[model samples]
Target: MWDYSEKVKEHFFAPRNAGAVDGANAVGDVGSLSCGDALRLTLKVDPESETILDAGFQTFGCGSAIASSSALTEIIKGMNIDAALQVSNQDIADYLDGLPPEKMHCSVMGREALQAAVANYRGEEWVDDHEEGALICKCFAVDAVMIEETIRANDLSTVEEVTNYTKAGGGCSACHEGIEEILMKVMDERGETFDPTAVAGEIKKPTSGLTNLQRMKRIEELLEEIRPNLQRDHGDVELVEVDGKYIYVKMIGACAGCQMASTTLGGIQQHLAEGLGEFIQVLPAEELARRAAMGA
Candidate 1:
């Protein structure tokens, strides 16, 4: 059994504002029985002031879900609409002293429902595909955009944290690999270390169809993808040679002599390894020059 915090248990056992608000100006509903959680939030606002005069909720899920919804209602009760909108899943968790990581999604549900209600109240229709990209988690109808947004917003670094925030890998776990890929992509976009070792499963071996030239082309393509990022800081990289499984490259401009040069080289190696295979090594020009000077 999970250890429920005292505040969580108190809210779960006796949820405040547990019913619907009469004559609510705005209402938002999200989740489903199939998804294992649902929330309906109704708010009565002082239209002139746009202040949330009262808030109420009806949640259908576990104890955490109920507590989350109840906590959300209490948090937004007297705040202006704009201020209320600023509340996040983390805010809900903090309000309840804290939540178990696995139950974090319950707070997410509360936050989403609140956003929806706010949109509905404002008569704003967001027809845009907020959930663009391929569906990655069929069990919860979650897409790559949802997972990516959750990961970036929460600074989620592990598969478990992603699962806790978005419920992406909480089902049969078939989509865990895809989730991992998205996590890596996000980390790369943020210019962070892309640690393949941190992820579960072995690094995939290069397939037989990849010829030597094709593999080299792939490496160049990946470097080209990273070139713009380096250029932003008055830096660049040039490919010196692709010798067998080794890639010899030289960093240019600011990146060449920076203390982070090795870190940059390591990042390149990790990126290529993620695509090509673990055998691919990226060596900086200085490292090769030192080896040659030593006559090794």
Candidate 2:
């Protein structure tokens, strides 16, 4: 079962600003009942000062979604619209003392609503439609742009993490690969590496008879064998660490910046898995460091 923080429960049970604001001048509507979550945010803005005088919401979803919408209204009640646009989904989660990772999309919806409302007040065009070929998760109507932004905003590294933050791959699993590709692109932009094991979730235990040292030695030998091929192209790979089924390596030289780095990593992973007779995932050294920094 998902654990609900106390603040979340408080807002859910007795949501503040629960109805439409009287004399509301700005309105933003997002999500859909068919998608299982919908929200309508109404704001009363002082046109002269460009300040939000009041805010209210009506939401349709689980407890988390309602609480998130409530929290958003409370958060921006007295703020300027420009300042409110800076409110990220993480800020909403932080306001509620943090949300369950699985429920983060609630906060994301809240953020989007705020942007839409602000745009409405400013008479700016805001389009949230799912363009053809741009939609990434059909089940949730999540698009690639949303997924990419969420990944960058939250430093998301895994397909599961992306699902939790944006609800992109949470249904049917068809968009898992697309989510992973987005993750890789984001990581590459950040000059970090991604671990495919996290995406595929196919880690295997070490072979029955091989000791830890034996496994480590075999992995290093396989990496050594792979190095010469990379070296032929003025690139190289160096083993960094071995933890369970994950073998972390650093790609140096041209390979580090290669557009086909993921493909090269996949080749290395396939080679190691075949040689070791087990499912082994090749990861970039930066992935290990990122996990450490996150205390995960």
Candidate 3:
């Protein structure tokens, strides 16, 4: 089990504000794409007093995120609009007594939702409509700074490489093509000394360095070609990696999203690996997710 902070647990159990408001003057909805946590905050305002009358929240999230939303509603109720807007992520964290680092973003989300609600009350859009800077990390709403730090810290060999290290485009994958373009530009300017020929070598079979995007494409291609064949047997397969010439595969699909996935990944996986090569390693996707979770 994760070591949740005491405050997180407390809020999870006896959350401060866990209901809907009778009459809300403004409502704000915020969604986190990475964790798929969504929240709606409603505020009832007193026009003459220029203060909040009541606040409530409806949240869909893990324990910490839900707790953060609950706590936020309690803190903001009866506060003036500007006063509520002054509440920060730090204040939320402090009010909760503190949250886990991984859960810290939940506090940020609470603040953003409150601010957005107030922004809505004032009739303003939070996001810049006109183009300013390109999205550098699609998975986490990260901008140029996040990508730049990863590139500089690891001296990234390629964009796909960044994915393995940071899990940037590992989700949804819509940002991969754009990420590729961004990395190339950054690397070119960062004294990589571009040469078309050697650069071409780096472009092909990038998994040698555990680069991210290329390997994802390669594995995705391997899955696309091979999975269809396995589907006939009512099985599943996932191509993971090659260690020294040994190819690895994991089973999923009807197998994983159902009860008999274990039997399929085990018995059927070996059968498929037998035909693939002697060096093939076939395992369950759960096993893979486990190994990944354990940093194996």
Candidate 4:
């Protein structure tokens, strides 16, 4: 079972703004039932002030999807349209405390709905067509442009992370290479190295077993290599615990509350997996504690 946070459960069981807003002037619809997720967002904006007077939504999907949509309406209700447009997928996740890594795509869907609604209000052409980029994920109808944008916004480095945030490489396993190429291109643009071995289907098994202490030492060394880059951004990562395949770390400084923290941890996990020649997961220390407290 997915370990849902209390806030997520709160919104899911009794979703706020669960229906269409009366007298809504803007409407945005995204996703399809065929894709297993869909959302319709309605907004009543004050024309002169351009502020969202009211917002509501109706979504079809899992609890995370419903909660994300509910949280989105609450987050944008009183904000100016311009500010709402600046809200990222990470913002929605943060609003709900956090989402399970596997369910991050639900937050991404919410962000897209908000953008579509704003564009509708503005009478701007908001096309979901794959005209700007190739169709990368046939299963999810995720295009290259969306994948690239999500990677850049979240600092995603591995195909698995991309799947977490965009659902791009999560289906059929055919788009893994395409996703890897996109990750490589984005990392290259950012002057960061992309480890091809980090691709979801290509990770190699550890050649030899090491003691827990040796594993911890190696993980620390790998983290030290990436510390400079994170430090430059006023963020840092601290090793917390090593439990089997899970490496728990604490994001310190500016990284702790960062909207992109999950993907930052994803990047760290990718680096460690490549260096250690093993498939491993990196998670936040807080998340570990939360699960333990819940007995999840």
Candidate 5:
């Protein structure tokens, strides 16, 4: 039997908003009839608060997608606009407790439908694929604006909080520390104080403890240690950074072109991140490759 998250099991059985709204103020459609997943969301707004008064959805997909859509509706029925907007893919995933790795895409569809609905409400169309600020967080196909806005919300009280608010770090944890940096800057600007605590036992070297050259030397050593196994497979894995509990890496070789590159990067990341903290963020090599490609 496919192992379902307990939260997933509950949502699948008793999805809250399973039908369509009688008179919707805004409607958004995503996915497709032919696509494995499709969603139609009809929403009612609280004119004054811009809050969601009621919402309902119709989904044609696997259990996760269907349940997620149903659950999404229930979540937004009475949430204010800003708060509802703050409801991230992570929040949905958390509400459902957990999801299988392969089926994670299903829950993502629920979030997409919501984005489309909100875009529709604003009378805006989906932007061009190559438009500026359009880096699709490939794992979930979510855009940067979504991440930036999600991060800006004070809801993300700390670095890991973004994982609870957005599934960004929950994927190939590449941007884990980057997201944290963004949040830290935001908090500072708002005169908010966020803890700089590292995950227990994670290597949190003081800023002045290791000079730039020493840090580079340390990373080189770490890479050298893993170079053999990587070369055994005609590959190279480079550790980009070791921050707190997150160990970011870049993989080169068969992995660079492999369809499972993300998977490979995640496996490597998981191994390294675990070396430090019980809770570690492993970033994929693809992110580094992509950045390199862009920089070049």
Candidate 6:
């Protein structure tokens, strides 16, 4: 249940340029039924001036998609072909006032179709100028080029923003890690520095001079904070004891036999490290026992 803006509602209900132009010299098509959206864009261009004489669209998508295609045509009409190349997904969204975050992909579709149509007009192969990297988001068949372009165009920082603009990590969520990698890479390329874990809400370990007893107390406090989330999954954790930098813990309840116990343990350890200090390490009861047996 998304709230469509007045302009979105207007264009969706009565989409302008809803049909294609006959004998059009340039045409671009993108998306598919399987992808949940499709668009066919036809352009009539002045051969000498290279200005867009007319633009029309045949869109097969949701309300936002239709509005986006219609809006794109209106924006590019009477503009130079070179100028039209600069129109971004954000521009399309802005033209329609603003779109809901989830519906931003519809605008992305418009930009892609426009690029394709322009390429067709030039008699050149469609080339993405944003990214020349590997395919990261397989769910929606989005590659790094599309994701990177959207991020750069909109200055997106968070995974949520990437998902909003490109629909990359929105499905299945297996590619979230890959999306994060690309985000960091792009940020680095822009000479911006950030704590990589900050996107996931992970705090970097702070340096603090404290006694062993104080450190143990702090670890207990952090564990208390994380316990509630584990409890919701019928899982629980107990502090065995703190030995030097190693904070040993025992998994109980469903967590004890859960196949994902190791993953949960790693998450807990990472949380502790971030909250306390990187020096603080977490080990399971079994690991502690084995280490003690080795006399090391």
Q: What is the C-alpha RMSD of each candidate to the true structure, in Å?
A: 13.1, 14.2, 16.2, 10.8, 17.3, 16.7
lDDT score, candidate 3:
0.65
What does candidate 6's lDDT look like per residue over 1-296, in tens digits?
77899999999998887798867889999873333798999999999999999999998898999999999999999999999989988789888987875576788789989999999999988865433345677554577777887778877677866764555675678998888888888878888764445554444545546777787788889899778857744578999988877889999886797665765676677667767755577788989889889998
What stretches of model 4 exceed 4 Å from their correct place? Answer: 32-35, 128-296
TM-score of each: 0.49, 0.48, 0.48, 0.52, 0.47, 0.48
lDDT of each: 0.78, 0.82, 0.65, 0.84, 0.64, 0.80
For every model shown, the clashing-pair count is: 0, 0, 4, 0, 1, 0
Give lDDT tens digits, candidate 5, residues 1-296.
65887777788888787778887777878773223688898898766788888899988787888878877887788887667767766567667875654565565667778777877887888442321234334443444565667767644555454543444555666666666666677777778876767441243432424555765565466456556645643567766666554456777874567565565555454434333324456676455566579983
Per-residue C-alpha lDDT of model 3 across residues 1-296, encoded as one tens digit per residue: 65677877988888776767887778888876546788888888887876988888889999988889988988888899999988987688778877754566688789888987887777787651222134555443445545666667867755545554454564566776666666677778786742323321132331244355654465456456546545643456766655443445666554456444443343333333333323335554455567679997
Query: Which stretch of 10 consecutive residues in model 5 shows the poorest summed lDDT?
Result: 127-136
Model with the higher TM-score, candidate 4 or 6: 4
Pick the winner on TM-score between candidates 2 and 6: 2
Candidate 2 lDDT tens digits, 100-131: 75576788789888888988988987776432
Candidate 1 wrongly placed segments (more than 4 Å): 32-34, 126-296
**Residue 230 displacement (Å), model 4:** 6.0
Which candidate number maximizes TM-score?
4
Q: Rank all candidate structures by their lDDT, best first, as comma-separated numbers.
A: 4, 2, 6, 1, 3, 5
Error of 2 at 56 (Å): 0.5
4 or 5: which has the higher TM-score?
4
Provide the lowest-lDDT 10-residue window in model 6: 194-203
Which is better, 2 or 3, measured by lDDT? 2
Query: What 10-residue stretch in candidate 1 is worst by lDDT?
Result: 125-134
True-structure lDDT of candidate 1: 0.78
Off by over 4 Å in 2: 32-35, 129-296
